[model samples]
Target: MKAALVGADGALLYEVRRATGRERGPDAVVEGILGFAAELRAYGAEHFGESALAAGVAVPGIVDAENGIAVYAANLGWRDVPMRALLAERLGGVPVALGHDVRTGGLAEGRLGAGRGADRFMFIPLGTGIAGAIGIGGTIEAGAHGYAGEIGHVVVRPDGPECGCRQRGCLETLASAAAVSRAWAAASGDPEADAADCAKAVESGDPEAVRVWLDAVDALAAGLVTALTLLDPRTLIIGGGLAEAGETLFTPLRAAVEERVTFQKLPEIVPAALGDTAGCLGAGLLAWDLVAPADGPAAVTGSGAP
Candidate 1:
């Protein structure tokens, strides 16, 4: 788990990273989160002469924000964890906001980064797994079950490799960074290969690397075309590790997206500004939004518009 003390001015006052200790069970992870928040609060009291009005926590998997329940996290082996209530009690009854990590990152990008001013936008993070956050009118549209933005699992190739979710040919199988690396390694007989090595090979014009890269891009473009047709988002912001390739990914991606569209207005494709910190900053924004006075606008710094 990662923790940060974000000031009212939007500056990160303190930040730390620690393991969730998943081997020890959900309760242990919850305790760690609570202890970390307490440490941040104590640090604030000593250095800033104030306490955090509220806290925001972002977690993976299906989250029911309205009910403050972490519905499921396959990675953490948790089901129905009452995160908000647990954190509220631990933080002396302060309000606690809970959100899905991808959605929160999307919210941050929409409000403060690449998607600013876009009425409709999508944030797709190409990490170990691929997922998306959809934003409309500055509000994230979490589906009724808080699974609205799970675009990664959309089937793109019917006969593709098996996925962790017990599915085959999902977009995640073909397009995610992990999938790219795995595919390259399998094709080249390099057990130790990873996505970075694949990208490097592609840059060097290796035939196997070119095939793997093009196939991944094609799969991603196919899924994105579906997203564009369904949501008509004005922008699509790409982040996570694969995004670091810059034009190496975007140039081909943009062309593919355009090719698939016949009449729809093409969305602007761009990179995320906040990078990996987007989730943390987005969590802070959500907490601040929850506690700020409803009658007036809260102060915003950096790039976000009120």
Candidate 2:
């Protein structure tokens, strides 16, 4: 987890990291978060002379942001956790805002990072899994049921691998960093080989690596184009571990996307500027938004859920 004390002007006043400790069980993870928030509140009071005015938390998996419930997170083993109310009570009834992790990150990216000035943009991160945030103006669309921007679940190949969502040929299963690592590990006969190694092999002109890289890129492009056709976003921001390959990924990705587009205006595909901190900064943004204009300084605490 990444926690921060942020000022009203969107400056990070203080920051810290902690383990989610999910291995200890979901109940323990909740306790850890509550304890961490309390510590942060005390830290802000000692150093800045006041407690936080509001708090914001971003969590993974399906979130009912309206009700502040973490509906379900398979990896975290959470179900219908009343995160906002819990945080608010722990913070002495201070207002709290809860958000989806990817959407929160996209919120920050839209207003303060790569998607800045873009009225319509999409933030897609190709990490252990693929997920997206759809940015409209400065806010992310959470959809009617908070399942918006789930482009990763789009079935690009019906006969492809099964996803955790119980569907076959999902975009993430084909093109996510985890998928690339698995493919490269198999092809290179190195049980420990990963996506980064595959990228290096591609740079070194290895045919097998080239094949794997292009395959992932093609899958990614197909998924992206599907999103593009629907959302017509002005900008598309790609982040996460796989995007660390830089132009080795971008150059081919741009070509592939172009090859697939016919009538769609190609949005400027860009790298994420904030990296891992985007979610933290976005969580801060959420906290700040909860503060009224009359609120002074707007000292706020924000947390990122694993």
Candidate 3:
């Protein structure tokens, strides 16, 4: 678990990281989050000389933001957890904002990072699993039931490998960081090989590595094309572990997207600027929203939330 207290200017005032001790179950994880928040609060009071008016938290899984509940999180083994209320109580009645991690990252990207100024954008993270955040007009659209941008589950190869979600050929099965590594390992007959090794081999012109890389890229492109056609977003911001490939990923992805588009305006594809800090920054934004009264459309930059 990780926690950070961010100032209204988006500066990290205090931070903490600790193991979730999650083997004990959901209660432990919830306790860890609350404990971390308490530590952050103490640090802020001592060092920053201020108390936060509100708190924002981002958690993995299906978060019902409107209801302030974490509906489900397979990794955390939590279901219907009232995270916002818990945090509010721990913090002594401060307002709290809760959101999904991916959506929060997307919110940061849309407001202040790569997708800034884009009316419509998609933030796709190609890490252990494929997931996305759709932003329209500076606000992320969480969809009905708060599960809108689960692009990873979109089947790209209908007859391909089975996925943890009990489906076959989901995009995550082929194009995610873990999937790419697994595919490369299988192809090379080396159980220890990972995606980074595979990328290195591809860079050295290894035929098998190139093949695996191309296949993963193709699957990703297929999924992205669907998103582009459906949303007509003005930009697509790629982040997470796989995007570490930089131009090697973007060059091919741009070409593939261009090939798939017939007459639509192709969106500019770019790397995320905030790196891993996006979620925390976005959480801060949410907290700012809770405390700072909104006069109109929230302006970008150091102007707080409103």
Tens-digit per-residue lDDT, 1-306, candidate 2: 999997776677899999999999999998899889889989998988888888889999999999999999998999999999999999999889899999999988887789988989999999999999999867889898899999999999999998888999999998999999999999999999999999999999999999999999999999999999999999999999999999999999999999999999999999998899989888878887877422212333243211
lDDT of 2 at 138: 75
- Model 3: per-residue Cα lDDT over 1-306, one tens digit each: 666777666666666677888899889999989988877877777776777767899999889999899999999999999999999999999899998999998988888799988889999998899999999987899997788889999999999999999999999999999999999999999999998888888888899998999899999998998888889999999999888888778888889878888867788999998888888888877887777734111532354321
TM-score of each: 0.94, 0.95, 0.94
Q: Which pairs clash in the backbone of model 1?
A: none
Model 2 per-residue lDDT at 2: 95
**Per-residue lDDT for 1-306 in model 1, tens only?**
777777555556777788888789888887888898888877777777778888889999989999899999888888999999998998899888999999998988887789888889999999999999999987788998789988899999989999888899999999999999899899889999988888888889999898999999999999999899899999999999888888889999999999989888899999988888889877877777776622111344443211
lDDT of 1: 0.86
- Preferred candidate (lDDT higher): 2 or 3: 2
lDDT of 3 at 257: 78
In model 2, the runs with Cα more than 4 Å from the true position are: 293-306
- Model 2 residue 242 CA deviation (Å) reads 0.5
Which pairs of residues collide in model 2?
none
Scanning candidate 3 in windows of ten residues, the lowest lDDT window is 295-304
Q: Relative to the true structure, how large is the alpha-carbon lDDT of every model?
A: 0.86, 0.90, 0.86
